[model samples]
Every structure is written in structure tokens, then in C-alpha cells.
Target: MADGDKTIEISMDRARLDLDYCYDFIAASYWSAGRTRGEFDRSVEMSFPVGAYCEGRQVGFARVVSDQIAIAYVADVFVDPDYRRMGIAAKMIDALHSHPELKRVKRWLLATADMQPLYRLHGYADLDDMMMMRLDEDARNRDPLR
Candidate 1:
């Protein structure tokens, strides 16, 4: 159940496990991933996914890949802009923090460009020794076609 005037109910249950609605929401939110529904569908088909709904419509989501003993990486978290500031993002994070399978993991990691304070509420922190790196995609694309 959700709090206050918010009409949505937050849940941690697996999404269709296919990125369909997930990426639709992602593309809608970020204008990135000129995605086809098929791509999202295939991606989540094999992963553990969670989603939120408002009036039975998906509004928020988060997912984790975990091993019951050691670690979990939380990824692809989002809530629609119209739903922002309504505590939806925090609720989604809380659901992940409280997940049963995730509890056994010794540690959890997540990557985000912003929203630090929101995540911090669930005890998330940045590790000093870990500097992040990413392959430059444009450079990768410049390689001669195979």
C-alpha cells in the first residue's frame, strides 16, 4: 500500500521479466533507447524484475540480479515524471532493500548519475576505492564493420 494522496500502490514483485513495459517507461522517461518493444521484451525475459502500478498501470520499477549469498546489483530503476516527488522512487528502493532474496547478499551496488540523497535513505553509499568506467560507445561504433 502507498502513503498519502498517491493513488499508486508500490510492489516488489517480478515484472513480466521482460523489458517490454520496463523499457517503454525508460524510453518515455529519458528520451534514450529509441527502443522497440521487442528489445525490452527479450531483455527482461531472463532477469529478475520488479515494478509498481497505479490504478493498475505501471508507474515505477527497479530490478536486481542477485546471488543469495554475496552480492546484488540494482539497476534500471525509474518512476514516471508525472509521478515524481510523490515518494514513488523511494518506495521502489525500499522494496528492493527489503526483498527476501536480496537480504542474503552481503552487499549491494547500484549505478546512478544523480539522486544520491534519495538512495541514501536506504543506506546506500559510494565506495571510495571504486571508480566507475565505461567504454565509449561512439568510439566502439567507429570500428570497421565486421
Candidate 2:
């Protein structure tokens, strides 16, 4: 954790997990996806999540939804606006891709509106037959906390 340069830390350690800071960072930086604190908390609770830090601050994050067998989806990746282009998210993803828990996964998937080049560097490509769909907001709103 230097002035502008930073190192990433990985933790399943509950004491080291900054759930509040992570929630705030995602809420402020990502609006198009309209993510909320509860969604962030639930994802971490249910999946393999990694949070990226810059100068001891939560800045970027992503998670893997996998059985560590056939499929792994990389989701909810975002970096703070002030720290963009510093390669923090790339490093975070690289760490996860190389993680031992993820070694068994044969297929990695991600949905990105941009950043295709970054993913391609790690051997991800366009899936021709795959189509993605989501439930309506009203349907999603059925859950009191989403």
C-alpha cells in the first residue's frame, strides 16, 4: 500500500472482510447494474468472492459462482472511478483465476459490457450459442431485500 501503487490481499478471514466498505464502493461506482448492499452481502455469503484493495481501501471486486467442476461465472466486477486504469481489477481477477479452489473449473464465463480485451488475455472468448436473460425488476422486487 504505497501512495499510488498498491498490493491486493486475499482473505476468507472474517475479521479482515470489510463488508461495509465493499458495499459502499460498489454502490457508488456501479449504477447501471443497480447493485445494493444486501446483494453484495448475499453474494459473498454464497459464492467465492474476492475484494481488491488500494492503499488499504476497498476499490474493486469480483466473485466466482462455481461448483469448481464444469462452470464458473465471473461476476460483479467493478473498480472505483478515481483508481481506474491502474490494473487493480485485472490483478484481482488474475489472482482468482489462479486460485486453487478454481483449478477444477473447465469453463469460465463472464458478462461484460466492455473490457473484452482484458478477459481475452486470460483466454476467455465469445460464446456463440449462449444467450443471457434476467428476471424483470418487478419479479426481482418480490424479495423484500434485493
Candidate 3:
């Protein structure tokens, strides 16, 4: 959803995803830097991917890793710089929640240095008591070939 001429359309189908655009954005992103196209494709294949398109070109993307039962881990949420603040991310999350396989999911998790307010609207609270711990190294120091 956008204000003016730029109307964003959300698609849940992985086949509709713009591989080059999504892979390029993730490859250069701070949180997912050095990720190869093959790895990105595999992730998309295994997860539920959402794409936001503007006039046919992909402008935003997000994905959820879930077992279709207990929990869903939302990840790789990235909106193109030009398409930010227009509710694309929120709409992606909405699509995830309304999805047939995920509508009944009891738990949802995501990690972000910022954007708490956005997730809060969806009832995600700060996990102050038990934080999400990761085993991998920081994305910035990670090797592309590793």
C-alpha cells in the first residue's frame, strides 16, 4: 500500500519472487551480507517468501521459516530504500499471519536492531526475560564462502 502513483502489490508465491533483485539486496545487506545466490535461493525454497512489487518490479521482500504448527521465525525482511515507510513491511507480515498454514501458528519470532514499533503493532513484545540467542557469527564478519 502506497500514497500516490506507487502502488505496492504483495504476492505470497515463491515463483513470483524476483530472484536477482532479492538476491542482490540480501547479498549486499548488512544483516545478510556475503550470502550467495544459491544459499538465498535455497532459503527461499524452504521458507514462505513474500514479495512486494511496484509496477511489476520487486521492491521489497520477507520470509518466514516455520513448521506449520508451533512457531514461525520471520527473517530477511527488507524493503527497498525507496519503498520504505509505505506499510509494505507491515503488509508482508499481515500476509504471513493471514496465510493458511500460518494463521493458527501460536508463536512468532523475529530479530531486529530497530523497527520494534512495527512488530509491536502485531502483538510482538520484547523478549526481555529470555532473549533469542544465535550461534552464528555477526553477518559483517562472516565469510561469503564459509
- Number of backbone-clashing residue pairs for each candidate, in the order shown: 1, 0, 0
| Whole-model Cα lDDT of every candidate shown, in order | 0.63, 0.65, 0.80
TM-score of model number 1: 0.70
Residue-level lDDT of model 1, residues 1-146, one tens digit each, is: 55465587776555333346667676675434676776666545544567777876787787776664456677678887777878888777767666655555556777776766776666776554332222222332332323
Descending-TM-score candidate ranking: 3, 2, 1
Query: TM-scores, in order shown?
Result: 0.70, 0.71, 0.84
Better of 1 and 3 by lDDT: 3
lDDT of 3 by residue, 1-146 (tens): 66699989999988889899888888887778778889999999999999999998999999999886667898999999998889999999889876776655667888887777788787777885322322211323423322
Give me the candidate number with maximum TM-score. 3
What residue runs in model 3 are displaced by over 4 Å at the alpha carbon?
128-146
lDDT of 3 at 142: 29
Clashing pairs in 3: none
* Candidate 1 Cα outliers beyond 4 Å, as residue runs: 1-5, 15-19, 28-39, 128-146
**Selected candidate, larger lDDT, 2 vs 3:** 3
